[model samples]
Target: MKQLKFNIDSKIKQLFQYEETKNIFDTYLPGMRSRLESQKGVSSFSLRKVISYSGGAISESAIEKIDQALQNVIVYVDDTEITEYTKQQPLTTASAEMKAEGMYTSIRPGKVWRDTEGKRIQTHGGALYYEDGIYYWYGENKDRTDGNCTVWTWGIRVYRSKDLYNWEDLGLMIEPILDNPNSGLYPEKHVDRPHILKCEKTGKYVCWIKQSGEEACFLILEAECFTGPYQIVKENYRPFDWEVGDFDLIKTEDKKAYLFMDVNHNGIYGFELSDDYQKAEKEISRQYENLHPPFCREAVALFERNKKKYMLTSGMTGYIPNKSDAAYSDSWTEPFQSIGNPHPEDESHSSFNSQISQVFQVPGKKDLYIAIADRWVPDYPIDKRRADLIMRSVASHYEPEKYPMTEEEKREIMDRPMLEDVNTSKADYVWLPLRFEDEKVYIDWSDEWRIEDYE
Candidate 1:
């Protein structure tokens, strides 16, 4: 195939007319213009050459495959300016002011969230476990620069919060075993969707992780405290020999724990865990059948409201947003009826362009729940050298800036080193208050909302 070379700098300058697009480019690909300028004369190369020049910063094979898929199309610079960049609204300042007043603050979805120490909360694809008036949040810690799923460096991270607005980082609960290739905690092996459940029978906190390797399974970890130095108990906790994907756990009012996972990316499957939360004793699907269409659903966020069990799942559109479906049942083992898109009519059909991570019930409140979703940033190109050109056009028309921090201000805003793979690493949480009325659930989009509003 003939190689194609497009001038990225000129293209960005011409295309990104509005400040929003420029800010996005600068946020995700910091110092990209200078880097491209330094290598301007040598920038014209094939996709493989670009990936090779990235030197582990990008995935070479993925870019080559993508380039092949595009049939190596050539482009010419045009005077047409992108108009989508003009839609971004200014950041909402009400939440910050509420925080300053020490009042119950609102949940601002898709914005950078910091802990008490002012560090970005690194938890993604995680669950909230409420215990003794405290909430513990645990999830995958993607602290690496590559932004590709192929590179897994850190294990699960834990954070604690009281009002569900301000979080305090509890550090990594399950640290990666960097040197142990045979261990399930190996750095390169993909481990995500960490859910913790306190076993009623044993009174021990158990964590269930979706381990993606040769044979995907649930790796069980046990710890005495919510903030844990957890130890792996079972490496392969498979109920029906199906490979596990994203998952969630729920304990019924009767004190029975059930495990929910996506089997082979097919559908959401339910398994009843042993009373001690150690084994996947029974496959609930044997009686209930698969909850949704095979290979159509993942990112399971299961919860219960008004004695009705509900599961919120996103269509299997990797890293891109799609419509979310909700299934509710009278019982965990019963067939769930599909409730089409629970979001408001004015909102994006794709659940505000985010995927449901968890739907958590408010502690000490009945029928009150919060729908947690991740507003995924655009996927970074596998060729870091071509990173500026990959998502520049599409990202111009998305969510408006929240705080409107400049690139330099954003870098100085945090105490810790900012996430390197800005595209994917900066994925922010979208927590919206979920309401149930007349047997239907509604997730309305709010720029900023206080927890006290629901109360």
Candidate 2:
């Protein structure tokens, strides 16, 4: 490649043409302009592209610094600029009464979700339960204070919805037991991934939560009502003598409930829940021991389709998003065959820069499932964390051909009324439609969609 000679000052001037781009450079490199202006030589540099350059002949140290600066510049465009621009277009809002009357509502992933009272939805890592014609969502009540902590100090939150779009907060269904130090719900312990199962024999509501602390285990609680002041029925419920991580409760068609958990950070293990869901009866790890790579899975979401059981699990990478894997089998106790990633080719592998929380069947709709995921934002200040910016990196890489949305489709999304809350943190839900072709499953990305679209 032919080299071009230009002073550092000239290059800086060229970058200043775009205001958004200039702002990013300034934010990432405070003294970049002055530092470049002070350099007095006609630098030997070759432009590979408008934004990329090569200075192979330059001093190695100087070249390294320039490379680092360029990388930082790339982060600015990749993360910050795109997210800010997309969110600038405001979403239209509808009246509460209108929404409650069965009006079609839009479901947008990574947008602020609010309840009937207009409070931001606090549920995270939750499960959906359909009972008596209402869908109840139960999840951890994440604290939204300055620290943006994930500890379940307020306990599990419950929200009810006739239609999944608009939810009515039922407050904290299981409050942290502050008075009893021996209680599993004690404030010091981090409680999360709340799964509720209604017993077929006794008609009692059973709740299971992963309690993390000195002795991490699954805590089982029960209540007579769906809206509960559930009491702790069992604590430290350890299956196969392993600490529980992210987990799920799946009730089979045969009325057998099973608890699937990340045991010892290894592959997932299945245990049969007793008739009342109060105790773990048998270890069924032998079935899926070969399905996943050892210690490679967590945050499991299990469901059945076309008479075959399927599971979606995230790699053990803390809060960062990774490619999710899937497995299936004819029987829950039989070995499942790995089907690789269930997402289409896109930025973030069509998982939408999130980890799977749950995969559930839409009420009254056959062969339709929704994959609920958490787009986890760093637990830090907005400016320092750059949660929106990080998401933008993933969003900007989305290939339109892979997930096409026409201008009319875009307008439809913007026109749909949604509740907004300024107090909410950057963490948001990334709910996508789960589609099955033959025995293989895939998740399709939609900007905004309604349940009727599937029907």
**Model number with the top lDDT:** 2
- Which lDDT tens digits does candidate 2 get at residues 272-333? 88898788888875433432322267788999987899989876534456567888888777
**After aligning candidate 1 to the native by TM-score, how far in Å is the CA of 198 from where it should be?**
0.7
Write model 1 residue lDDT over 63-98, tens digit each, in one string: 544444334335333322221112333322345432
TM-score of 2: 0.66
CA lDDT for candidate 2: 0.64
TM-score of each: 0.67, 0.66
Judged by whole-model lDDT over C-alpha atoms, candidate 1 comes out at 0.64
Clashing pairs in 2: none
Q: Identify the runs in model 2 with alpha carbons over 4 angstroms from their true place.
A: 1-104, 145-152, 287-295, 378-426
List runs of model 1 lying over 4 Å from the truth.
Answer: 1-104, 148-150, 286-295, 344-347, 378-423
